[model samples]
Target: MADIEVFVFAVEAELEAMDRERVGVHRRGRKPDLALRRRLVGLVWTLTFGGMQWRVAGWLSGIPFTTLHSAFARWARLGLWRRLGQRLALDWRLACGDEVLPSAVVVDSRSLRSAPSAWARGIDGGKLIKGVKALAVCDKHGSLLDLELYPANTDDRAGALPLLSRLAALGFQGDLLGDSGFKGAPFATAALAHDIHVSVSPGGTRDGCFLPSGIRWVVERLFAWLSRYRRLNIVYDRAPDLFAAHIWIAMISIISRRLVAQTHT
Candidate 1:
């Protein structure tokens, strides 16, 4: 794992660039006694490596449980995790001599079983799991670009529309490689509007193993990487936004580590 300080620094830089007001820094108050750096470092550590409860995390970090929870909630609500992940991914790509913007993206989804108390969940008939579906888009090198969480009942094409819309909204004009579930005229037509060509991978063999497909594997690798984070291996968050934030946080950690390694080399 990379040092927590690197993740904290990258996030602070992003927050400053995106305007600190979003985190309520400009609000009229006595101001927090704890430094934002320490709080953020603790928060990232909890999200990335600590699977314990927020209270336990706070105890370990020497911050009040409520304070840590409230700060995390505020940042999640403000979409800070997602923004920071994007910024770090871009920086890593640039540092590795890749294009600032990807011309191609791979899309995939994973169905994770939810906790008994989780609110937003549905049965994935294909996977036969009662949970939510995590749809993600990644560049050729497996860097996360965007993610969406929806009910498992949602078909791939239906669940994928929002992610596609987001990519288009971000002015992403290129090709998208996906699995057989994303094939069809409707998706193709939708992607055409954004000047994005949708190419679905070939079907698997009768034994249930997919034939080798070069481009589409990157998204699968991303899912594998995300699964390493205990927080992401299962759906524990009550709200979809918070779940998405955790995914972003995990990616932030991954990208920041890559950036740090690149800097050293």
Candidate 2:
């Protein structure tokens, strides 16, 4: 692993960028008491590696457990996760080149089992299995170009449009390919409006199609990278926003690794 200080500096830069975009402010909030941030990063590293509890994190960082817990909650509530996700995705595009522009791009979704605390029961829906589905778009190098997350029961197809829209916002205009689940015309028409061609696998025909398998696998590979962190493997935080922060933190770590690789190359 790289030096923690280098990781901290990269995170601090990413955080500042996120704060500016999400909160309309770029203030560092009293220098974050570098000592505190250092300890916080340590805790994150522990939880990320499937270590002990917050108390253990505190003991390791030499800070009170409650303070660490409180800070984690506060940052999560502030949409740090989404910001981190955006930052990592953007960084990937800048470092690896955007495949969605003038080339074929892959779109897909993945289902993850939910934590007990994350379960949601509806009045008429009954107690259904709780989980989340994430939609991701990526280039050939496993670099995230776009992504979105929603309740496990949410239609995967429904999430596709938002991810597509995100790509558009980032100036991606090209061909998109997906499985048959995205058979509806809405997404096709949406892409068409942007001059993007749509290719969907046909039903009952598993043999042949214009497969963008190689490009599409990049997003799945990114998910694999995310699962390397335990905090992201499960929705331990009751609040969605907090769960998102951990996700972003994990992404930042992956992007940092990629950045290092690029510099050496």
Best by TM-score: 1
Model 1, TM vs. native: 0.91
User: What CA RMSD would you report for each candidate?
Assistant: 2.1, 4.8
Query: Could you tell me every candidate's TM-score relative to the true structure?
Result: 0.91, 0.75
For candidate 1, the C-alpha RMSD (Å) to the true structure equals: 2.1
Clashing pairs in 1: none
Worst 10 residues of 1 by lDDT: 25-34
lDDT of all predictions, in order shown? 0.80, 0.64
How accurate locally is residue 139 in candidate 2, as Cα lDDT from 0 to 100? 61
Write model 2 residue lDDT over 1-265, tens digit each, in one string.
5735445667666566756575632235544576666667657655765636778777776789888877667666665555565566666666676532436677776666666676432121222445776676766566555666677666657777666666777677778877776877887887787777787764234564334444555566778887877767655556656565666667666677777778888
The segments of candidate 1 whose C-alpha lies over 4 angstroms from its true place after superposition are: 20-26, 29-37
